[model samples]
Target chain A: MNWLAVKLPVLVTLGGIFAVLLIASLTVHLLQRRSPGKSYGELRSRVRSWWVMVGVFSLAMVLNRNISLVFFAFMSFLALKEYFSLIPTRRADRRVLFWAYLAIPLQYYWVAQAWYGMFIIFIPVYAFLFLPMRMVTIGETRDFLKAAGTIHWGLMTLVFSLSHLAFLLVLPGAEDKAAGGPGLVLFLVLLTESNDVAQYVWGKSLGRRKIIPKVSPNKTWAGFLGGVATTTALAVGLAPWLTPMDLEHAAMAGLLIGISGFVGDVVVSALKRDLGVKDSGALIPGHGGVLDRIDSLTYTAPLFFHFIRYLYF
Target chain B: MVRLLRFLFFAVLVRLVVLVVLGLNVRRREWLPKAGPALIAANHNSHLDTLVLMSLLPLEMLPRLRPVAAMDYFLGNRLLAWFALHIIGIIPLSRRPQRGSDPLAGCAEALERGDILLLFPEGSRGEPERLARFKTGIAHLTERFPQVPVTPVFLHGLGKALPKGEGLLVPFFCDVFVGEALHWEGDRAGFMAGLERATARLADEGRFPSWD
Candidate 1:
């Protein structure tokens, strides 16, 4: 009687997702074994946790239309926290950073409420003024320039950059779709994270030439090219389900995220080097920390969000 | 609340600026035995000495290490005074040589409370590259609080970082050398001699320029 409830479409989508994740996990596991110098044994547990995160997010996407925006908003907050912790900011900047933290909820709320015009100005123009004014009021007069610089940089990197994810969710025409934003969240998540995972995998396998010797020693030409290619292929395959695009558009999106993610990783790495810290914190298991995982997303999320908004919205 | 805010504000400012300019070099840091009263007898080098030590130690250990600062100097400016009293939790000592207002009493109280007090035995800023004579106040401190182990500390390059009577901060690498705690028997003369030996040892260690 309820055979329709478990239709081919639902079963097929679920089965396909399970199979993909299973294969990815197994590949990473085997990759770990083959690799001589591994980062940590706890990496296996982290990969398992990633599987759980993907599974839960995928289920949430299918179950509700509104939840996807909330999901990405939470992810943005974690990423931003990781960012601020790793980057060194002065005391005079704390008040401004407190205000910047306020931006997280407001930006996400704009997405949840579907308010477009406000989120746009909230970071660029409004935060720009408010932060500097905060520093000026402190009356230290000495080191005022440094204070201002710290505030502005922290705001731009953590709040303004992360607001893009929310921007993606509220991208018009994404509403009332059967695919529930047409698997846009899933597509973005997969491409960004897969770029990271694939790069690490390939780099470990055959990474002889260092891409940027100073910034990230582990990053290699082999890893970068391999990751971009594999992610592009995945994007092409998932295009029909995720977007109203053919293979070409998906490939372009993957490329955009892949390149931007690489830049993001380098930028955050530079910050870590400046602070003389290895990991932002030891909050995550195999991954260095939340910052290590989301370094790519800090740049990629906003870039991809804007690209989608411009082309499709 | 204003004072607390100011203290936090200045602390963060110094931490941030130092992070950029000097660059922290905390390779291996360890706290002393957590249970007992301890005295960290450091040399008076520069303004950056306290900051260097604070940054080097883990936050868990920071609350216990109270840097002893002069009430007249640190408390002279209202902002610095607030930071010293509230944020840094420095044990304030009067520079005026009055006897009743025993500066070491505060250190004793802190020790009784099971807190670690950082005392600069040189009493005032000296050429950090050279060891200044051990001030009598530490001898007096040990004679009174004989139970607490006097930990000798020497700060290298802090004089270059923020030299004596300097307004501008000099950017340079500084090292905070913490020697093993000095053992004190119940005898006062023995404790004083032990403190001197520990101080000399730390000064010698500071003389060795950091390879880093």
Candidate 2:
């Protein structure tokens, strides 16, 4: 058995997360009591939901490696499901949606095999080509272009991009400084999620200028910069035990996740606006749906993976 | 023993499918009664409707929950009849009531036992996700017992998933909207209209993946 992967740093990193969640819970509870209204009530539920989300995530990480892969694949499935439910598809593409879903496991299989080449191109190159070809065979010309673009885009955002998280689990380095791939996954997730929270808090407290008023009205320059700085500092602090990156490189990775996380988030916001919905669905209480929670990760995972891959590997 | 089988099959197996494989997005679930002596009127599209509703409540409520289904169809043969009666606990309401016999008798008895009666007012499954004309049975039953709460539920995605003549279960996310519980509005036409209006409101709430 390899003792390197399952060691003390994993526990320490998890403990640190738990401590931060505890403070958040207590703070939110206090805020709710001090100023009980709709917003604070929502904040309370959001914090409560965080506990369950983190609990499930931590359990998956501590389990067998295959379990970890399955967990990520399941998340991909949920995000894809939410995306499909929200969008309107042509009658012809409905059957093609099944093929899109079937690709989830095949995409994850590449991750499990540690075949980076095939994993990178399976959805973008192969799925991109094959989905349209299958639709052509289905004999549907009406709205063919629109159908092809939306289906392939859904697969890329929900399955292909998110699969990078699982692929990080199979990546060959970070075994010594961090608790292998789980640590890197943890680092990316923790920084990204906390960045979201930090931005919300900063915007609510001191936001004066809207970053992208049309796309996401709630986003502010104050929040954006504040979140990036906080995440960068956090990354530098947490990189020693959870990542192989030194302080300088860790800060760079932090900037990458922070900026791309914002872009990913706003893109989902644009999607919801187009669909005329406040939230995607009601799967997660306080957090609209699986898609809502994983939107930022859809970008952060892939960008951070390649960043680490280029620098470390 | 059979009760245990039903409970395990639903609490474990059916719930696994509903929760993971087939996602369920329900609105206003608190409107459902924890105990029975109530009627749950929903639109039926697939056989999965019964299972999806069963999965919503706690498992202990299974014994008292009865779906008022067609007798000849659900209990056509010994094997299916046995499964329906023992495992599903459906009240066998004969679609064609015998002369001078009450079709609603079984349902009334189930309600008298403080059971939750799941009724499909549309009488039978129609096209998936499309509402069909509602039968007057629900109104007649409610008029006979005006006090019982009838929860109007609108189900989507199941019909698309496992509609009639379809064997493969498409894993589409189902939307269940539990409308405000209504009561008998004195007359059959008025009550039927109210039921239609309530279900229509719920149907509009769902963003169904229909090709327009």
Candidate 3:
């Protein structure tokens, strides 16, 4: 193992995360020093939680490839578990759920083995067919359509989509093949997360026109545009160090992450609205749940992975 | 020896596996008394219902919690009977009437001894999403031991986790909503109906919330 090659990107990513957190803390504290409202405390706690998240992620990246794979796999497990907990299923779909849970490990194992063909289609094609087949064999036809749909949606969002992060780590190319996989994963996560924050910040500062008031009242056009602009600039600036892509492709990737991240966030909001819950779970102190934190990645990871694969690989 | 084994098997192993596998998210746990002689009455959905309830309680209460399981089902097999008897310490109540023994007698004795007993007032597992008419057995016990508080617990999604007659267990999320405890007022039918209503209210809470 080339220790310096791995350590360089990992250290740079960690340093970047520290600088962002420090600046965010200072800015939020300054903005709220005069009239500290609920947002002040919330932003403080959110920054605190980000420290833990960044620490753990950096540790995983620095350790080994397998460790990072397992970390992402565990993340998918938590997200899927939260999804299932929120959604209602018919009794007939019980056995089918087992099959759904089983897909997480099998999908990640393919990523570990670098089997791209199986990784891409395992959940969508195979699990989709197998889940309904398992439900049909149970002989409880009542609400069969709803049951199968719920499980398939969960598998798609939680396992199949999230697996793209791990898949990105295994892509074969000149740069990505040279242990640049972790850097790409870090780059994608950093841009997506920063975009989410930029939207929230800009939305609160200058947001007027609601984008979709019914589904998510907090989302606004100002937030969307500001977030896209900021994230696109960051993507281009950090492309050389953190990703295999150049300025133009990195800018494209930025737009994709920004837009899809908003979509994923709103989609999860819609789900919570339908289910009538505030947050998915209370695992994270400020983030509400693992799902709440990673909702944007559900879309960005898969989309960015494919984009990278198509262009570079 | 039995206590240690029960802690190891039921409290530690079974609870961890069940919580992870079923993805159980227990709500309104504050309704469950931290330490008291309360009768926990929940709607039966699957074999996992009891396990889910047990997993949610404080570990200290596990040894004292005696889930009233069906003698014909849990105790029919020797291995299961041993585990239920020794590890889970279930108070087996035979559905079939014996020659002279009263099924409620064991429950009353456990309550008198200050053990928290989990009773499925529905008598047997019913179809998922449907609550069977609760039998008078809970009413009888509550009447006999009026001091014991009957807390209504509604289990949602266990049926989908391990429904009746399913050999394999499914990994689904199950929510346990704990409601307020009811003290008997010397009315059997009214008390039973009130318990059922309380459980149904919790079911609604689990299915949908008043606010998003």
Candidate 4:
């Protein structure tokens, strides 16, 4: 509570986000009142979901630290579960999945304790080795390699990658000197998600050239470049208030998130394409699933965490 | 009272497990019958299927909702039988009724009273996440009351969450797809065929990733 009360910038940033969402809500409502057709239904759901998502996320960010950690861990669990559901898994390794899920809480536990040594290598090193051994105990070696690879890959993508966000909350300088850990997290997440939207809007309106048509047909060079520019400018604008970085460094961080956010989005598109599904699951109304919503965070969380750690921390 | 216990079991315990432990992604909920004289025939993968389906209906229907379970399996002892029959409100069907006794008499009576019967046509839990051959019991029950609408439901992921023999209940997200209801068109064979098709169609609608 003291952390939130002490930081004016953190409160201001959260308030600004709600204000922007309020405007978006107003815009969507006005359009719907004017048209009142089926076209606005999807827009209405999307806007409504945005309200809930932002509300939940901001509340978690400002609450107790343990609750915040648990929130992120639950998101990781959803992403991991979605990945498990999407991929074709060998039945022999059904029990092996328990270990995969067990890694989530343990990994987050390390983050909570700020034990970087264990957090850095727990999934990639320990779980990576333990999963195969656990599978071999079942004595089915036909598709052992594939099963092992898929499970570990999901853990890395969903659990290990996303845990970095929670870890960012406990960084050395995260407590007092600047906008605080929540600010850094909010900066990364806000920029990454906005970058995703910026790219989609840019590509939808003025996308003429597809960057990688095979992987993601919706993505275009215009969207990619435009998203990067917008995100970069936002990073520059937000850094001084929400982060410890100056304008130049914020722009650099923005460029990283903008480009990496697109990469992460298309990377998941490649996954869904290979698996031959439209979206991941039907958890959220307009959004496909937890995995669909956090795909960019999977990439940006780790990238931005390491970027800040390497530069300032 | 027994009714209070049953209400607490479903309204509190079962709802907690389903909503908290196993997040449900229920589809076509509007297709679910809001009233009685209906049958919800879901594919049996895990024991949780009965509880999950029962929780989907309105809590007020707890008095009228009954799950058709095996007599020998659910009622091996007096204490267990009491809990299953009263708390769970299960209409136990003796798989082997001695000397020409009408085993399905309880089910028919329950249906006659306009109770919503939760039945697993597959008879028992089979291989996890795999559809087993449905026994003729569903057809027999439906034939007795042709007007009772049987809603075919397909449940996914619960088998892996807690399967037939597995005691460990891992948290896995489950999906429930409710399909259009069917009625007895002709004989037991035709009605059975329709039930099979309805269930299989709902299963395909699940669109699970092809299991390796």
Most accurate candidate by DockQ: 4
Looking at model 3 chain B, report the run of 10 residues with the lowest lDDT sum.
B203-212
Ranking 1 against 3 by TM-score, winner: 3
Complex DockQ, candidate 3: 0.26
Interface RMSD, all candidates in order, equals 12.7, 2.1, 6.1, 1.8
- Against the true structure, whose lDDT is highest? 4
Please list all clashing residue pairs in model 1, or write none if there are none.
A91-B12
Tens digit per residue, CA lDDT, model 2, A166-272: 98888875565466888899999999898898888889998999999999999999999999999999999888888889999999998998899999999999999
Better of 2 and 3 by DockQ: 2
Off by over 4 Å in 4: A1-6
The 10 consecutive residues of candidate 2 chain B with the worst lDDT sum are B203-212
Q: Is candidate 3 or candidate 4 better by lDDT?
A: 4
Candidate 4 lDDT, B1-212, residue by residue in tens:
77888889898899988987788889899899899989999899898999999999999988999999998999999999998989888999877778978878999998889899999988888888888888888888888888889899999988978888988887777999999988788699988888788878887776677554
Q: Which residue pairs clash in candidate 3?
A: none
The C-alpha lDDT values of all candidates are: 0.67, 0.87, 0.82, 0.88
Better of 2 and 4 by lDDT: 4
Which model, 3 or 4, shows the larger DockQ?
4
**Number of the top-ranking candidate, with TM-score as the measure:** 4
Ranking by DockQ: 4, 2, 3, 1
User: Tens digit of lDDT per residue, candidate 1, span A59-103?
Assistant: 655554466566666565555554544444453344555566677
Q: Write the per-residue lDDT of candidate 3 for residues B53-168, one digit (tens) a residue.
A: 88778888887889998889888899999988888788999899778978788887777778899889888887754689898888988888888888999887666666677778
> How would you encode candidate 3's per-residue C-alpha lDDT over A102-143 as one tens digit per residue?
898899999999998898888879998898888778888877
For all candidates listed, what's the TM-score of chain B alone? 0.80, 0.96, 0.92, 0.95
Q: What is the TM-score of chain B in candidate 1?
A: 0.80
